[model samples]
Target chain A: MLFRIIKRTDLTGTQAVMFRTAAVFLALLTSSVFIIILGNNPFEVYASMLEGSFGSVYGIKETIIKTIPLVITSLGIAVAFKMKFWNIGAEGQIFMGAFAASYFALNHADIPRPALLVIMAAAGFLVGGLWALIPAIFKAQFGTNETLFTLMMNYIALKWVTYLQYGPWKDPGANGFPKIANFHDNAILPKVFGVHIGWIIAIVLIVIMYVFIHHTKRGFEISVIGESENTARYAGMNVKKIIITSILISGGICGLTGMIQASAVNNTLAVEVTGGVGYMAIITTWLAQLSAPVILLVSFLFAVLVQGGAYIQTAFQIPQSVASIIQGMILFFVLGSEFFIQYKLILNKSILKKEAKGGI
Target chain B: MDFALLFAYAVHAGTPLLFATLGEMVTEKSGNLNLGVEGMMLMGAVMGFQVGIATSNPLLAVVGAAAAGALGGLIFAFLTVTLRANQVVSGLALTIFGTGFAGFFGQKLTGKIVPGPITTFFGEAKVPLLSDIPFVGKILFAQNLFVYFGYVAAIALGVYLFHTRKGLNLRAVGENPAAADASGINISLYKYTHILLGGALCGLGGAYLSLVYVPTWKENITAGRGWIAVALVIFTTWSPYRAIIGSYLFGCLDIIGFRIQDLKIKVSPYIIDMLPYIVTIVVLVFISMRKSKENAPPKGLGNPYFREDR
Candidate 1:
């Protein structure tokens, strides 16, 4: 018997949802094998994972804290991906954003709190946008591979931050071991409830992004260009300008994420400011298929996994890296499941009959 | 300047990269751009170290490393080739999987060094007569077995890729899979074969670090060498021979960062360390700027081929 995969004419929304759900289920099912091998009950492990993320107010807050960066960065990535531009430099972009914001806050410590925050945000937005612009311009003009370019940019940005923390920006008063200087009271972001205002910004941005992508003329241009650059040109859209603008916005939002991480959360510039959220955002954003609402949900799920993963480290003696393994398995399953969503496997009836006759 | 010493160090540093770059090059030539080289290398490093520690056999370590690396590659091929998924996403997932998987197991080997016999097994095997030549001999002929293996592998693969019938077919598969398929080539089989082999080579490179070069287990020991290897494939314009030279040049650049730091220069060493990646971007731009067909990446690179798809 032989089977061949045939492409489907169209995949409905329901089927996509079903496939995605199945992928998640299958991922968990496969993950159970690892859990069992580790001598932990799969059910108890999963229960603990949930409890670790949402068991207490602090756990919930931590999950939200993680989600803020993941959501904001993924949103920024969505804009670029929507335009078919692979902006993988969100890590670098986030660092630049954090660096710029910290620089502003450090130099303008005398400024009023509100004005200082605004300036820091602007600095972050502009710097992050500029960092992203380098590759976008190169990509638009020379057709350079942005994926590798962005990847390289990440290490450069990381090294730059490392240089700062260890060299000029090191807090001298702390003495030895190296550390970035903390923001002054006025420079720090104020909290509304228990958590900082980063999540508030993220929520507001989500609404704006939804409106921007669905209702705005520029958003229409982005979708058109993403679908086909030639088609966009034929429609009289300024392709280069659109590409530049989209990535700038994408990068600007990523910068905002960095700014929040620095001013609100870390309260200082450090190499760990981005905290691998930039890379994680890539997976979440891609997994969400660039949908704003879906990104929020996916980001929340990822944040839970991260927060819970950390919990498992202390709670169950599981290594923190296990989270990455679980996430990777989930991504692999979903990525593979996409094939089934797009195509159908068909058994060859004629081949089966021929096989049966030959056997007889 | 001690040119011979630098050359020897450069050869030592670049061998692992050469293994990885050659593997990535072969995989890329098969039209699947697998970006999980870093992950594969890390897994190879950890797995190879663990096995070497257990068996006290360098040969077994080498095989173990290759097998672990091939497993990483197999995961990639299964997702991208068999399932017709997005190559970039799948590659990234494979990377995440490999890095974490390696890291999770690698904690046990913290601060552990390779077994003594394993090191001696991979130790320098100075060529019989070639070692007698004054300066050039030490730089070229005097090296560990893995270094020699790199040379043999590079030359052999270089010749095979350009001169052999199967190599031509593989090139054809990369350049134009649909056309190759029409001409009776098994596109999927070629892709899976090369990608798996490429991954295994990357694993071997990782193993080299643990077993020969550093010979100690350190977290993220590959530390962007795998990435540099990826860039080297592009920098060398996808020729295995050029990969050898490219890896050495990059290896020299990498070693120079530490060498200069030892000299106590005022400049931050990290800035100097940024040379390879920055140069990679510049080389990529330069390569793109030339806009020649010969210098171009394989036409079908990063695209999944379905026989029915027009």
Candidate 2:
């Protein structure tokens, strides 16, 4: 059969949604092969996954905890992505933020609860912002590649934290086990509805980001820059300044996630505090298409996958990486499906007729 | 620390980076910027180790690793080249998928030793006449099969990229796909071939990590070497010959921290561990500052080409 790929100029909203849903279903079906390979029933595994994530109050709360960092970091990534800036260094920014917050939490345990928490948040914002600023400056001044620059920064930030954990910041009383001192009670974030206040913070940020992106002049400027830097320049926008400012805000929010995770989740700074959430957020943010409300929904679903994946590890003797495998497959299917949405394959009648006539 | 020993170990360490950088360089030359080298490497490492364990053949393990890596490249090519999806996101997806795929299957192979025959086959051996030479021979010629392959690959790629007509055509496609297409060069064919070939090389690099470096199966055996290889491509300005030097320098940086600790230096190893990444950033900044056209990336890089749009 002769077929030609044609671009679809008028895809509807419902069609796009349908395509995405099908992609998710296809991803699950594809991943079922692996479950079958591991000698388990795909349906049973999936049922347990759903049950583990939302079956009980504790499971739901843990899922929420997982969602918090992802939502906030995705929001931060969405802002930079809106400007076409590839800030893949959220992992580093998160680490720097956690490190900054830990500094205050460990050193100023005597400070009152509310003030200390406020101070830690501010410090995380500042440190994370500054850490990200280095690359933005280089990118603006020299037109350097931001992707590699930011990626390199992740390792630097990680190694710096590792240094502290084993060297200057090591808790001497812990019998030489390499670890930083835990945060004091005053530094920890309080709980609301069985989840840390980070959930409330996440919701507030979502509303603020939605308004900021859709309503504000700065947001419009960002979109313009994203579409075309030349267009933004022609419109009298200070491209360099806007890039720096947006990245600062972006990195600062990611840093705040570090503070929340450190204070509320880990109750202290640790190397695994981010738990690959920074990289995971990049995926979620892209999947969310840079929308704040959509980011919330996407991150929640991903958190369920993660929580359920964890649950299956214990319940079915499956490897923890099965979750990652499923996530990756889902991303692949969804990413591939975007093509089908934008274009379609149609049988070429003329070519088919020509071939038929030649055959005759 | 013995200088000769240090240099020798550096070459051994840099073999994987050399292979990966060369592969990525070729792929980029085809106008595709795939950021999933780390993921591809993991896939290669795990698969190569598994093959070695199952078959007990070093040659088959190497081939298997390259094939696995090419499979990853095939996926990226399909998404970016065929589907015309955003290259960056697709590459990231490839990375996530490859890493997860490797980890999922590699769970059983963890801690398992590479088969005796396979290890022995890949073990270091001295070239007869070359080993008789002085310090340089010991440092360069006395190495495993992977190191030798890296040398040959770098030299061959350098020649092919500069001295061959096909290489010129590839460069033309990267520089201006429309012009290349106008000249009757099959853009997709060139991209698919180079990308797959590049992936194969990346796989060999990963296999080197498992079959030679540690000689055991382990999850994430490549660590960040794949990323380092990506950076090295920039540091070399996409030159295969320059990749040799860049990879060795990075390899030295990778182990210098431990070397300093051996010298009883007060400097923390963690701080030293930061050097390669820091050096990469500094080199990138310098490269950008130069503003040399020769050092610039391919013009059509990271963009999906559609003939209809043109």
Best by lDDT: 2
Q: Where is model 2 chain B poorest over a 10-residue stretch in terms of lDDT?
A: B85-94
Query: What fraction of the correct interface contacts does each predicted structure contain?
Result: 0.66, 0.69
Supply the TM-score of chain A against the true chain A for every candidate structure: 0.96, 0.98
User: Candidate 1, residues A296-334: lDDT per residue as tens digits?
Assistant: 999999899889889888888877767778888898999
Question: Candidate 1: fnat, from 0 to 1?
Answer: 0.66
Candidate 1 lDDT at B82 equals 88
Q: List residue ranges in candidate 2 displaced over 4 A.
A: none
* Model 2 score (lDDT): 0.90
Q: Which candidate comes out best when scored by DockQ?
A: 2
Per-residue accuracy of model 2 over B145-207 as CA lDDT, tens digit each: 779989999999999988999999999888899999999999999999999999999999999
RMSD in Å for model 2: 1.5
Q: What local distance difference test score does each model get?
A: 0.89, 0.90
**DockQ per model, Cα:** 0.70, 0.71
Clashing residue pairs found in predicted model 1? none
